[model samples]
Target: MNRTEAHFIAQDHLAREGLLLDRLDWDAWLDLYREDAVYWVPGWIDEDTLTTDVRRQVSLVWHTRRDELLDRVVRIRSRKSVTAMPLPRTTHSTSNVLVESAEPGRIVAAASFIVHEHHPRLRRNDVLFGRYEFEIVQEAGDAWRYARKKTILQNDLIPTLVDFYNI
Candidate 1:
């Protein structure tokens, strides 16, 4: 497919992920991850160098494989994960979706995302703004799956505890 088409497909996948999460479709959402996918949210670093070393620096959440992702999904769905309870009303807003690189069977995509979370008991809504960097692989029938996803949260002082539960 053309790069433009690939870009839209990837964008659609991102949108689908949001909808799945909002609807609490854990199984279908888990399908978005590839067998060897890496899902990472890095920890804070110095302002001068906007990058943090994934190897040495601590990350908020890092799942090395799909199995790990499955475990997370199971916990969140089972009402065992502390961060998962109450199911905050969330809306994922994504923009500036750019296809950075498109190879034969893969696409490198980037986008800015804003997740608005509202808890029934909370006084105000919590917003998480970040950039999503993804490596999406083309699968059978030219379908797309997430090979890796790196989220960079802009807020150094996050409003609340950060976790992958919303994802």
Candidate 2:
């Protein structure tokens, strides 16, 4: 496929993923990622730098496998996780999707996102903004999945819990 076509595919995929997260459709949202996908949110090292190594440095969230994501979802669903208990309502908005590079079976894309979150228990509202770098891969039958997702959280001084749904 051409560059334009790849961009469209990436845009659509990202849009759908955001929609699912906003709807709290965990099952469908999980489907967007590959079984071996990497989900990482690097923490800031200093005022000017972010952590570069996942293993050595601190990270906000780092799940090397999709099953780890699934485990978190299970905790949230069962209300077993205190932080995720009474899961906050969230609306994820993704924009400025750009295809940085594309090959036959893979594409690298970047987009800006804002997640509006309302905590019912605390009666508070918060916003998280970030940029996402996604390594998307075309699977069999033209389906697309995220092979790696790196989220850069701009406002790192978080007030509440941060999870996959909210960032």
Candidate 3:
């Protein structure tokens, strides 16, 4: 495929991922990634550039593998999770999409997203904004797998209460 074709495919993949998250399709969303994929919600803007220990560098959230992500999903789905007792309605809006580059089988994408969450029980309509930096690879035929997803939150240092179900 050409660069334009690869970019279009990557953009579509990101759009689908946003929709899946908005619908809370955990299983389908998780399946869109490779088994060794890394999901990082960095605590600092330059976390990627910094070579220091992520744990010591104030990382927000990090999942090194697909199994870890699955575990988190399972934990949130469990009945014992108090934080998730009253599920919140979430809508993810993604925009400002830019495809940085495209190789033979890989595409680099960047986009801005706002996750609006509303929970009647908590009387909250919080908006979580971030930028997504993704490395997507074409697998079998038209299948796309997320090799890496780096989410950089707008407010990284703030101590905020996040529901376990929030993604």
**Best candidate per TM-score, number?**
2
Model 3, residue 145: what's the lDDT? 90
lDDT of 2 by residue, 1-167 (tens): 78899889988998899889889899999999999999999999998799999889999999999999999999988888987768888888889999999999999999999999999989999999989999999898878999999999999588778789899
TM-score of each: 0.91, 0.96, 0.86
Which candidate number has the best lDDT? 2
**CA lDDT, candidate 2, residue 81:** 92
- State, as a TM-score between 0 and 1, how close model 3 is to the true structure: 0.86
lDDT of 2: 0.91
- Candidate 1 lDDT, 84-158, residue by residue in tens: 466677888788899988878888999999888887656568888989999999888856789999998888578
| Total clashing pairs in model 2 | 0
Minimal lDDT window, size 10, model 1: 44-53
Show pairs that collide, candidate 3: none
| Location of the lowest summed lDDT over 10 successive residues in candidate 2 | 156-165
| RMSD of candidate 1 to true structure, Å | 1.7
Ranking by lDDT: 2, 1, 3
For residue 85, what is the lDDT in candidate 2?
65
Look at candidate 2 and tell me the lDDT of residue 59. Answer: 95
Between 1 and 2, whose lDDT is larger? 2
Instruction: Note the residue pairs that clash in candidate 2.
Output: none
Candidates in descending TM-score order: 2, 1, 3
